[model samples]
Target: MSSASSSSVSAAAPASDWSAARIAEAAAEIVAGEQLPAIVQAGHPVLRTRAVAFDGQLDAELLDALLTIMRRTMHEAPGVGLAAPQIGLPLRLAVLEDTWAADEEIAHTRSREPLPFVAMVNPAYIPVGDGRAEFFEGCLSVRGYTAVVRRPDRVEARWSAPDGAARAAEFRGWQARIVQHETDHLGGTLYLDKAEARSLCANEEYSARWAQSTPEHAARALGF
Candidate 1:
């Protein structure tokens, strides 16, 4: 979920409960032959639970099905990344992709770039250095909001691919942010834990007031 504060939105109930209705609705569609999967929101028990590592499930039909559903769900959310806990599954799995083709403004501000879709199982990461950067972040699970968060500027991640091949890679820029965000889900860490609470706002409010602003600008304007 987005690093946005949970207090920003005044939902009917908690976000998790309210979003469950939509998730159930999505499940109903799936039962009716729709392939899209539902996305669970923040405050869900699953999101707070640390995920289990995949054992020898690579060859299992269930794993294959889950990956398929997750990919479809990621694309349907129109988000660049997703984690299993965001879907009511406390599994250490995540998927990510970014065409890095948002309008020039966003692309440059977030350091976006093209990256092929990747599915990582039981991923882990380490900071590459003392360098840090702050950016406005968003998440599909924490819908309709964004907040400024500070994180290491780069990280090296190790994980098993969907095919069961072990791999490790260093990431930087927006790509690093995406990796950090998704992996955090596996550890039951939500972005809000690192977010500047005063910077939280609805997506619409963010777009109107801070979309053109950087994290530094937001901090100055919002007093975070």
Candidate 2:
């Protein structure tokens, strides 16, 4: 699949250094702002660069503030998840939560489930069992379109929690998909890298023709 190589949005990034005090100061500036920080979009260098793994870059109090804003930004974006690079911070931090309407049929077909908010640092995942689920996915960075991406249906997710404690758990269904997408950000990967080019469609087209819970119809028509 050919990846789009264009961008129409950008952000003014804070300085990138390995200093804890500098990171804390920049993060504090963000927390102090009234407006939501700009979400860096496609073609931004930070989004394509590997993120620095969290390693006590910020003290506990500032770390909490950073996580809080990340969480709030995700909710405000009305997206299920967001990554640090998407906000112009090249740190291996991400926030994820899944919420949806109570449509029984859609919920069952999409394997949709609600997930509580999580802040993961230096996260990674491995497939639990091999089987694939293909669905239309989109990203805030790659705004205005979505494509069919096949992903593992289950995974063993692991990461460090805000309290600097190690955490691991099994996730399946849509929750697993969320984990894969967010974790990919840490490695400088986007869903489009794994998407079927034939299934790429603008958001309007998706609403008009391919909004099904499953991408079976899209896959067949697109011949992926």
lDDT of 2 by residue, 1-224 (tens): 01110011113333344456655666788888998888888898777766777888788888898888988888777788888878878778889887646467767976888888889988888887787888888888888899988888888888999898999999898888888888887667788888899999998888888877678887888787
lDDT of 2: 0.78
lDDT, residue 107, candidate 1? 68
Please report how far candidate 2 places residue 222 from its true position, in Å.
2.5
TM-score of each: 0.82, 0.89
Q: Pick out the ten consecutive residues of candidate 1 with the lowest summed lDDT.
A: 5-14
Q: Which stretches of candidate 2 lie over 4 Å from their true place?
A: 1-22
Which has the greatest lDDT? Answer: 2
Q: Which stretches of candidate 1 lie over 4 Å from their true place?
A: 1-35
Cα deviation in Å at residue 13, candidate 1?
22
The count of backbone overlaps in candidate 2 is 0
Clashes by residue pair, model 2: none
